[model samples]
Target: MDKKLIEELKLKLLEEKKDLEKILKGFAKKDPHTPGGWRANVPKYDGGHMEEESDEVEHYQNLLSQEASLENRLKEIEEALDKIQTGKYGICENCGKEIEIGRLKTYPAAKTCLRCK
Candidate 1:
């Protein structure tokens, strides 16, 4: 793989990592005990209306789901970055073949080629 292309992918991954963390922080806090862990903020009871309380609960549940999804994507991006460091970037993990450049450009965190995926 070309060094320039790898560098471009690295930049894309880093930018995405930043964006994901920012989005997660809007509704979740970083977990101190585990690396790259996020805990969605729980809605607190302020003795408001019952309807409001229920709405808050529903929002909290949605945040939890979003947090899980973002965390998983972050992990995949981190893994891809690690592969780049180890000189394994662009190789499909499932088939040990070079991933298509177009696919990698579209999804820098991809773990497998289109066929394997």
Candidate 2:
């Protein structure tokens, strides 16, 4: 892999990591007890308004789902960054081959090449 391309991908991954953290911070709190863990904020219930409370619960559930997804993507980005430091950034984890430059450009965190994928 070209050093310039890997540098570009590293920047891209860093930018993506920043964006994911911003979105997760909006509705989720970082878990102080667990590194890289996030907890979705539960909607506060007031006066036990049954129907409104139910809607709030549903919205909270949706936020939880989104939080999980964003966390996973953040993890992937972190792993990719680690690989970059180790000089394994563009290598496919599945087949031990160089990942296509185009695929790396499209998804810098990809672990497998197109064939392995």
Tell me the tens digit of each residue's lDDT in model 2 across 1-117: 788888999999999999999999999888967555988887888878789888998999999889888999999999999999999888899999999989998999999999999
Q: Please give the TM-score that candidate 1 achieves against the real structure.
A: 0.94
lDDT for 92 (candidate 2): 90
**lDDT scores of the candidates, listed in order:** 0.93, 0.91
Per-residue alpha-carbon lDDT of candidate 1 for residues 1-117, written as tens digits (9 for 90 to 100) = 999999999999999999999999998889977555888888889999999999999988888889888999999999999999999999998999999999999999999999999
lDDT over C-alpha atoms for residue 26 of model 1: 93
Worst 10 residues of 1 by lDDT: 32-41
lDDT score for candidate 1 against the true structure: 0.93
Question: Model 1, residue 106: displacement in angstroms?
Answer: 0.5
What TM-score number comes out for model 2? 0.95
